[model samples]
Target: MKLQIDRIINEEKIEIDEVIDFSNVSMPVKIVEPVKIHLNFENLGKREVRVSGEILATLRLTCVVCLEEFDEKLKIEVDETYIPETFIENRKEERPIEELSEFTYKGSYLDTFEIVRDNILEFIPPYPKCPKCASKTEEI
Candidate 1:
């Protein structure tokens, strides 16, 4: 879950390859398998890091209409900017509230698993429906 970025401080880009087990962490939705995440962390400047990656997993979803359990392939795009605490502390008042996509980190290490899990979970449908249920509802 911990991603070390010390090596990439000098390099322009660093590739992070990890297979994360999210069973231990409390997730918003049920997951059926481990997530495969591949990411690239690029140093934007002195204290900013750009994280771009792809996540793939299988999620266990319950159909809201039919009440059936089904597996769904979850794919998510990871794109975010991380700013150091030092920078945020100095310019917190200057930055606009609407620019909330930036994440703040205290140190060199980042919580890769947690960040990716949160982004992926946001894509889940609030009221999921199975194929049969969806088709039936369409005819009504």
Candidate 2:
């Protein structure tokens, strides 16, 4: 989902609520269901935008303990800031370490799909377990 930078700047804030299809994209893990995202894009001056919202999705994962397939529901809260790509070039020398950690966008649009994909990947469990195995472990 690409959003126009100009519109966000003019309106100061934009709210998005939709289900996005990622079947065509190559994802590291299997996303069994469409991703539901409710996001707020707020222009924070100087071409910087703050993206805050929630993402919900179901992922098909393999349980490490039982070696069975299971669906894991994810509800991730997002709070990120994006700066213009050119800002790096302009303030390379003066930019602080923390500022360098923010995401950057180029040209006239902000590609939110990438951001959503990255966050999903980051939130995946390192060791996934099926409900049966999870409950068994808890009982131990």
The best candidate in terms of TM-score = 2
Evaluated with lDDT, which candidate comes out highest? 2
TM-score of each candidate structure, all chains considered together: 0.85, 0.90
Candidate 2: 10-residue stretch with minimal lDDT: 92-101
lDDT of 2 at 50: 91
Candidate 2 wrongly placed segments (more than 4 Å) = 93-101
Clashes of each: 0, 0
TM-score of 2: 0.90
Where does candidate 1 stray beyond 4 Å? 92-94, 138-140
lDDT of 2 by residue, 1-140 (tens): 79999999999999999888888879878999899999999999998999999999899899999899999999999998898888877874776777644888889898778878989999999999999999999999
lDDT by residue for model 1 (55-132), tens: 898888899988998888878888888888787778747778765778888877878877777777787988988878
